[model samples]
Target: MKTLLGSQDNWDVVENGHEEPVTTEGYTNAQLNALKVVRAKDKATLYLLYRAVDKSGFEKIANAKSSKEAWDILEKAKNGDERVKQVRLQTLRGEL
Candidate 1:
């Protein structure tokens, strides 16, 4: 997934997340176009992510604001959170 996104120059959007340009004060055409590009890439990434996961997994990232946020949520769900990892490691050490 990372490789795929990277090949299309979208990994940055999914890794760092794109900031939506503020529109309250109005913007130039260039700014709007730039935002459109970023938004398109982000939506594409999101579509890929949605297709990659199952129902339960989908639920986890359903409310994610961005690809990066969804990626993070999925990663933690699959790998477990830091505390969970620590506990698992402790159990392994005890078994040895």
Candidate 2:
């Protein structure tokens, strides 16, 4: 999946997430163009993520607004929360 996303030049967007360009009264053509590009990439990456997950995973990310959100949902579901991980590690080391 990482390889596929990287090939499409969308890995960065998925990994870092994008800051939506703000449009204002003073917005320039360049900003509008950048906004279009950002939206397009966000949708594309979201589509890829939606297709990659199974039914259960799909449920977790169904309302995600961006690919990064969907990716984070799957990551947390698979690896658990950071606190959970810490507790698990401590138990394994007989310190919990």
Candidate 3:
């Protein structure tokens, strides 16, 4: 299955113990607008694959905070890590 998240998360909102808050208590118009763009981008990326998920599949990613997290969840659930995929490939080659 194709991973929904694109390679690299450029707009990281969360860090060690701090997160970019949606609250704009004392921000200029430009900062607020930029924040809005970041939020929209994050949400849009998350929903890109979310909307395509079937009802049962939706449950697996309903609470994902970012696209990468959601994509990883789906990948892991499908068949496990890269090692597993390589093993499966070898098995199929042998069978054939």
lDDT of each: 0.86, 0.87, 0.66
Q: Write the per-residue lDDT of candidate 1 for residues 1-96, one digit (tens) a residue.
A: 889888878899988887775562587889778888889999889888998889999999999878888999898887776778899999999999
Superposed Cα deviation of residue 58, candidate 3 (Å): 1.7
lDDT of 2 by residue, 1-96 (tens): 899999999998898897764545687899778778878998999999889888998999999988898898889898876778888888999963
What's the best-to-worst order under lDDT? 2, 1, 3
List candidate 3 segments past 4 Å from native: 1-19, 78-96
Candidate 1: C-alpha RMSD after superposition: 2.7
Query: What is the C-alpha lDDT profile of model 3 across 1-96, one tens digit per residue?
Result: 234333334334221112358678999999889877777766776676587678766899998887667766777777665778899999999999
lDDT, residue 60, model 2: 96
Clashes of each: 0, 0, 0
As for candidate 3, its clashing pairs are none
Query: What is the Å distance of residue 22 in model 1 from its true position?
Result: 4.0
- Clashing residue pairs, candidate 2? none
